[model samples]
Target: MEGHKLGRAPNFTGACIVMFGVNLGWILLLLFAVYGLVAAIFLGLVVNHWVSWLEHRKQLADQRYGDVSGDT
Candidate 1:
C-alpha cells in the first residue's frame, strides 16, 4: 500500500472518459431500440385498424345495409 498509487489504477481520467462515452453510446442505442419497438407496436395497431375498415367497407359494398350484424 506504500508505493501502489492504488486509488483508481492508472490513466484514471482517460479511462473514466472512455467508460462514459461507452455508457452514453449504449444509452442512445437502447433508446433507439425502445423507440423502434414502440413504433412497431403503433404501426401494427394502425394496420389492424386499416384492415378492419377495409373489410367493413368491402362488406358494405357487397350489401346495401353496410356490414350490419344481428346483435346491434
Candidate 2:
C-alpha cells in the first residue's frame, strides 16, 4: 500500500465567507424581484385609476357641453 501524504486542511474562514457571499447574493436577488413585482403592480393600479378618472372627467365635460365638433 502506498503511504498517504498528509496535506494542510482547507481554509475554513475563506469557505465560510464564500458561502455567506453566495447566500447574500441570492437573498438580495429575491428581495429585488419581490420589490420590482410590487412596484409594477402599484404602478399599474395607479395608471388604471388615472385613466378611469380622466375618462370620467371627459364624460362630465361632454355632458356639460354638447359635442363642440363643428361636424354637427
In terms of TM-score, the best-performing candidate is: 2
lDDT (C-alpha) at residue 9 in model 2: 83
Whole-model Cα lDDT of every candidate shown, in order: 0.69, 0.73
- Candidate 1 clashes: the total is 0
Off by over 4 Å in 2: 1-34, 70-72
lDDT of 2 by residue, 5-54 (tens): 88898758878879976975675567568787676566556766987999
CA RMSD of each candidate after superposition: 23.9, 26.2
Model 2: lDDT of residue 16: 88
lDDT per residue (tens digit) for residues 21-41 in model 1: 697567556756878667656
